[model samples]
Target chain A: MTSCSGTVLLSRITAGIPHSAAYDDLPYTRGGAVDRDAVGALVQSAADGDAAAWKALVDGLSPLVWSVVRAHRLSDADAHEVYQTAWFRFAQHLDRIREPHKAGSWLASTARHECLKVIKSTRRLTPTDDPQVLDGISEDRTPEESLIESEEAAAEAERIRRMWQEFEELGDRCRELLRVLMASPPPSYQEVSGALGIAVGSIGPLRQRCLRRLRARLVARGVR
Target chain B: MNDNVGNDSFDEAAQDDALEEALRRAAAILDPVPAELRHLAVEAYALHSLRDLDARLAELTFDSLVDALPVRGADVPRMLTFSTGDLTVDIEVTAEGLTGQVLPPQPARIEILGTAQPTATGTVTADEMGRFLCDLLLTGPFALRLRTDEEVVVTEWLRV
Candidate 1:
């Protein structure tokens, strides 16, 4: 798989040395960028055994995966399991990815599939897509909130905690949509649609509605 | 009137954008991807090396948990099937361990792949009947790598 050449190329790229005049064409050069073309290039390089390219790919797309898993409201352990499984499968199939440019969409779909499997395996009822039905489900504090306590300032942390309390009041569907939309570097609507199994055209309107609902809740509590 | 209406909608969108931006920032701090998970994902890249280039991936065709209806009040075992056109592996995962058969009934060596461990957590060999049993119950993400006389086949990764 040209492992030697890939290593040489990656080392040169990583060392800030131009391997060729087409240095811009090197995938690792665009480290942490999450565009379709950049993703495709990283996938190719990773498949060729470039570790840097693989790390870049994971760094860029892990948030999308995390967001998708959290959207299913799985327990932290289950979510971690699903996250690992999705990335593991993706790693196994890295060479065979038909559309490397759509890696974000692929990871999102895989995460969603794994989440459903966990839900079904645990005998939990499948979450309804209807936002109204989702409104009835109550949420418990996630482990992340507790983790945030040590890292944030006192008043700021309190405000964030209050904001999250309101955020939890959102319906499942709204929460899911917003969660995916909130991914770091932000995912494109195409990726969000793929992640949520919603129409691309509907994302804007849905996101608008979800945000409005979250804002109203936050405002009522004087936390916004 | 149309201009005013358009401006109103734009303003609403802008407001939504502002609120979403704030929430996104907060969610980043509140629910950032755990560092360990990202590290694990990066480590997964090592799973497929040049030596595994020829190994056929057995795609997961069926999983009882995802495809079959639940039988109430029963401790139903999770069933999984993976295939690669010519080869098939069917597994039943119970509380105690895993039992599975490599179809076409030929002896083979199987390595249980677990994400937690850098290497295969365990190895078991199938008998002439292509059936094998492992008494060690598995947890977390796992897969099976089968090494037959002719070729190597790896199953889809799953959380057991």
Candidate 2:
């Protein structure tokens, strides 16, 4: 909770000047694997009128993009709408981006912000439902409650139902930790630690413990 | 216990190092990305293809998501309006598909494109007043390109 509010300091090493250069600097990939320069250059290429570069950016960042929006568990229609608009906003403001190379985080933030709009509008449409849907998200409710709510609270019991229920039984902290872990393409431990407000050094050690605890809960309940 | 955990290596170097692969896989099953998500993300990039350096939509004056006149009844068609450098196009969208007209009207060739394929996948001609309609069932992202003896005008790609 404390960690997510931390400034998402993107690698703004590139000059903030828009359209000043092609994506020549290296851009890094998910899992911290090196492609730093390639991604940087790709963004530049996209900015400088390279359609292929733009395509490459989407191809590479699709997992992150999908992950960020999918994390919200919007109805399929709303999810797609948010997805298209995220890219559309990028397309419209391509020139204004301060650091085009850090588009992964930028797009992630955009999709996350867009989720708020959709969730709010959805509330407006359904007056009889819980208005606390997502408004309480940035505030009080635990990640476990939100995850259940996000995935459609009234979903009838099924296989995944057991899994989610078992997941919820892992307690608040583990549920929050793993929720961040399951993010598409998965965020780095440092990013995860920062977002979740856990100590950076303990994230790796804690990840194993959390998953192991969840496994134990599942096994104890006779869940495969 | 696996010897890996006993090591004091809290650093990510030997940390996640694929240790959580199973959890990652299980989580995927719990919440899978729609198969079409990636394709549509890619198709969204086709809008960038319209970035031919200078040519661009002058302004997207109106869109249903924004300043659309609200419909009080059911089966209302969604609407949008865009102004390029020279011409302005007004469009109405519905479950049946898209129909539109260009301002300062004149005869022109209209191409309805499926973003899953190439641009202008299917072509139609507008009547003398620059009004054109298409019955193409849109299942994916798309763009519209209008051509005449004067020049070619293309709208940014969109999902209808």
Candidate 3:
């Protein structure tokens, strides 16, 4: 089952590339830009049985889904299950998705629902009144020392690591908002609103306020 | 003063943009989505062909985990209900296996579908009374596909 040729092709297609080349190959790439319309095309094609298009969608949107799952502070195992379930559900609902352009929003909403389900089940089993206590317990970090060949890169990595420490110090709401906002290739304000259950109109102002607070924290720590 | 305020706000926005970008780069490098998970997601698309597109999806109407209040010290089995139109499938999941009933009291064939397994892990036949039991313990994400005399139905995926 694991030896499906499609799996091999997909890994090759997504391997080491930050974004899918298939995604970049879309006609919508004016100056190598990514927008909702391009995503809509991929969705439509995948719904029509295009495997490459499906790979593109997975490569492009998985990070957004991952961010939403992580924001709930679930264990890595639980988060993995949620992430897998969300994508599987999305694959099943590909043809029925009413708004292809808003697939990111669909994914975000699904992941959020899955996260809530996991939290509820775990809370029932463990009887924890505060879910926040589950926080910081799943800090699995991948070593990137091999990637830090240059002193300059090492210094930059350290700076960002410290910035992350400050980022963690922000309030839960701010941290969650920023975490979702940091999704690579970025997600739309509509997607962010769907993921975080915030008003779409409020995202800009809330993001500004949250970032201002984070920046202040970083400045105080002399990390910047 | 108004011009200065406008410039200050613009600069703040720029700074925020830069800071967000840096954090995004760091996250990509530090806390990436596991390669295995990404592979699974990509492989999920293959299920698109495996699933009968015409099959009616049994919507998950109730899940005990999300719905029921916890009773202290009670050994609560995970209860789930999926329904579409007049049909309902109620499943009770315990550590040992699954016990479910296809409502309206009809016989059917049930196939246990796991995400990792390309094919159905096992198939059980529901009796005339609409009750079926599977002794095989389920792990990870799973779903049920029911083939009855009238139509085919697939339940929503859930993790055990």
Candidate 4:
């Protein structure tokens, strides 16, 4: 569990944050959720070609993009490229991006769009065809399965495994909705609406339904 | 009746809040963001700057991929059309490279940048007919920075 100092230093250096407690004080985190103001300011600077500011934006929003790509059940390789291409598209569109603080939503939608395109073309499915019709996204769960298998002596890990098992059993729609919401610095309803091509007003009801379903399954499995 | 409905919804809201708390922890443990992906994205920020061209580019109005007729034994070419109120750029992308034409047949210069690379991968200039061909691009993220008469316009980054 011990990583070398050099690895830690390199990560900090690439992420463009000095070794300080400043992140805690930054306005990025609010009530344990991400604050849009912090992200908006970074977008402004990053659009103006400030590399450090861009790096900050990346650190903040990459998880949301990862969530979108993973939702498609892409191969790890495609998922990796999805992360790169989504940020690339964001960079190019940065100047045109209005409501800079909502960049997380924009990035998430773009990543989802990218995933849809990749999934469609590779599977030779029509754009109008339901995504679920494309062989169910290959489920490429080897990594997740292996990680669960490797859990040793950890009660919490065991609980998470149980929760995940229940998660996998939910209907596709519920699973997809919760997966998107699981993103760190979770996206706004408007963003999720655009990304999933669902009606804006429906997301809250959808979330409630999905969450209730998940809760029922977890409780049934004795997650308590 | 309204008050009863309100109370019922409030109870549901509290339960959703608690489920959210469980989800927060579960997502963190189950699908934590991969470190390498974050590093790649941060590194990409250093690739190029879009400081000068702030004006929004045109939206894509047409695509050849729509209802594409399958051609036997040939790779599919992805064709895209983007336009502003008065300008249009049509591009056809294939494994070989990209072929594009800017409207009204005017001479122009274009820079192809791999958005994740530190520099432009290739550059091409269109003739008076407004037609240009680019070198084969790396199979990843890319953007086209075109020099118009009045200013520069960058296309949305796309997969090639």
Give the DockQ (2 decimals) of all models.
0.41, 0.11, 0.48, 0.37
Docking class of 3: acceptable
Ranking by lDDT: 1, 3, 4, 2
Each candidate's iRMS in angstroms? Answer: 6.7, 8.9, 4.9, 5.8
- Quote each prediction's TM-score: 0.83, 0.53, 0.84, 0.73
> How close to the true structure is residue A211 of candidate 1, measured as C-alpha lDDT?
88
Superposed by TM-score, candidate 3 places the C-alpha of residue A215 at a distance from the truth, in angstroms, of 1.2
Instruction: Write candidate 1's Cα lDDT for B80-99 as tens digits.
Output: 99999789999999998999
To one decimal place, how large is model 4's interface RMSD in Å?
A: 5.8
Tens-digit per-residue lDDT, A1-224, candidate 2? 32221111122222242220111221221233213455566666665666666666665566555555545556666667667766765765566578765666567666765665555434433222222322322232232343445335323113345656566456556765675566544565544543455676887667778776766676788765
- Give per-residue CA lDDT, model 3, range A90-198, as digits (tens): 8878888999989999999888888887877676322212233222222433334433556775676678677776776688899889888887766788999889889
Task: Give the distance in Å from residue A212's predicted Cα in candidate 1 to where it truly belongs.
Answer: 0.8
lDDT for A15 (candidate 4) = 44
Q: Model 4, stretches more than 4 Å misplaced?
A: A1-31, A48-52, A124-153, B1-15, B47-59, B66-74, B84-87, B134-138, B147-151
lDDT of each: 0.77, 0.56, 0.77, 0.66
The single-chain TM-score for chain B of candidate 3 is 0.90
- In terms of DockQ, the best-performing candidate is 3
